[model samples]
Target: MLSEEITRLIGKSGEPMILEVERGAIRKFADAVGDRNPLIWDDEYARNSRYGSVVAPPGFFGWPVKWDSPMPFFSPIREELITASIKAGFSRIVDGGIEYEFFHPVRVGDTLVAVAKIADIYARETKGGTLVFSVTETSYTNQHGVLVAVASQTLINR
Candidate 1:
């Protein structure tokens, strides 16, 4: 029961936003995830590994960064999807799950861009009530256009 306008808005996926990877940001993200892996925190250890420099954790790519430009229409893509579902007519909503596919390690000093899209939308009737779900897929690529990682998140509505 989402309004057509809101549905349309949510459906419009914006262009990818580019971001620069910083050593400090990577360390912060590692700490936030409580991952103290030497590969992420120690340059000496990282240099000897296959990756010549410190690399970010797979989950670190999901971190948000401040941009100088006006924020995109779908500010927080996940939240926008949930709000859109509510506006359409769903009474309750929840975060169903997230699935990630890593293509390459996010290395320090690599400039990356996040290109996202609404991959799918569907509804079903359950014992609890009617449920709607939206799947948003985001692809992260380095400046060289190399695929880095892809994250698919599902949002559930009831």
Candidate 2:
């Protein structure tokens, strides 16, 4: 059974992170995702495109937070925040899905600031198993203070 105190832990926030998008990172991601788009790797190709210099692909912002490093690490900010909102005893945790809305195009050299928090917590019993669902709403803004993206993650803890 989940405790009331833990259930009341909704709205708790985790450490905020700031990330800087880099050209190399964009190229790496493009390659990893099997995107052979010349614009992502070839400067000459991207120069003539509407986005100008290499632009990051959509969902690239879903990657880790890198302040100045060439490559970012999975910080698990959403998972950590959700953990604090759930009581002990969950056997498994899996990502249900993420609803992401992009407000601006993420470009190389853009610095993004993100904040993640536990928005809701609840539990239900199903024919398969009893599970707790934790939802985290994270909003990312650019250094210019303009909202860049919002990612809502639903985690199933069973």
Candidate 3:
């Protein structure tokens, strides 16, 4: 139940936050996600793959940088966005779906920055009433600005 004004305000552009992806971080994400892929854990197997090095799980590319900084957004954009939606008065918000496009394989020790933007917002009338759908797109890039992956997530607010 975000106020219309606040929703509009949230639609406005904000500063892009930087997130560094490290080796340990990727491994932890793989473990948390319950994806025990050899490419993500076995360096020997990874070296034999097309990537020629340790390749992170495709979904693990979204892991964020956990630095001791005052800016909370530097943590994880996905979690922050969901928390913000709840705080904005949404009685319940669920992750509807996610789509990701991979341009390059994310490897261990790759420092990446995730730049996120509100891609779209709309509402639909359902049996439960009007539900708002918010789509956010995040692009992951390495320190050199090489695009690594693009992730689009849909959140359903009711």
- Best model number under TM-score: 2
By descending lDDT, how would the candidates be arranged? Answer: 1, 2, 3
Task: Write down the TM-score of every candidate.
Answer: 0.81, 0.82, 0.76
lDDT of 2 by residue, 1-158 (tens): 56775576578775678777888888888888899888778898888988887778877753455443332432355545445544466757787898999998887778887787778888889897778887878888887899988888888887
Query: Over all chains combined, what TM-score does candidate 3 have?
Result: 0.76
Q: lDDT (0-100) at residue 80 of candidate 2?
A: 54
lDDT of 1 by residue, 97-119 (tens): 98999989998888888877878
Task: Go through the candidates in order and give each one's C-alpha lDDT.
Answer: 0.75, 0.74, 0.70
Instruction: Report the C-alpha lDDT of model 3 over 34-143, residue by residue, as the tens digit.
Output: 88888878889988988777767786663544544454543344455556667766659777998999988777777777777777767778887878787878778887
Candidate 3: clashing residue pairs, number: 2
Q: Clashing residue pairs, candidate 1?
A: 1-88, 2-88
Q: By lDDT, who's the top model here?
A: 1
Q: Deviation in angstroms for 128 in model 1?
A: 1.7
Worst 10 residues of 1 by lDDT: 66-75
Q: Please give the distance, in angstroms, between residue 55's alpha carbon in candidate 2 and its true position after superposition.
A: 1.1
| Per-model RMSD to reference | 3.3, 3.6, 3.7
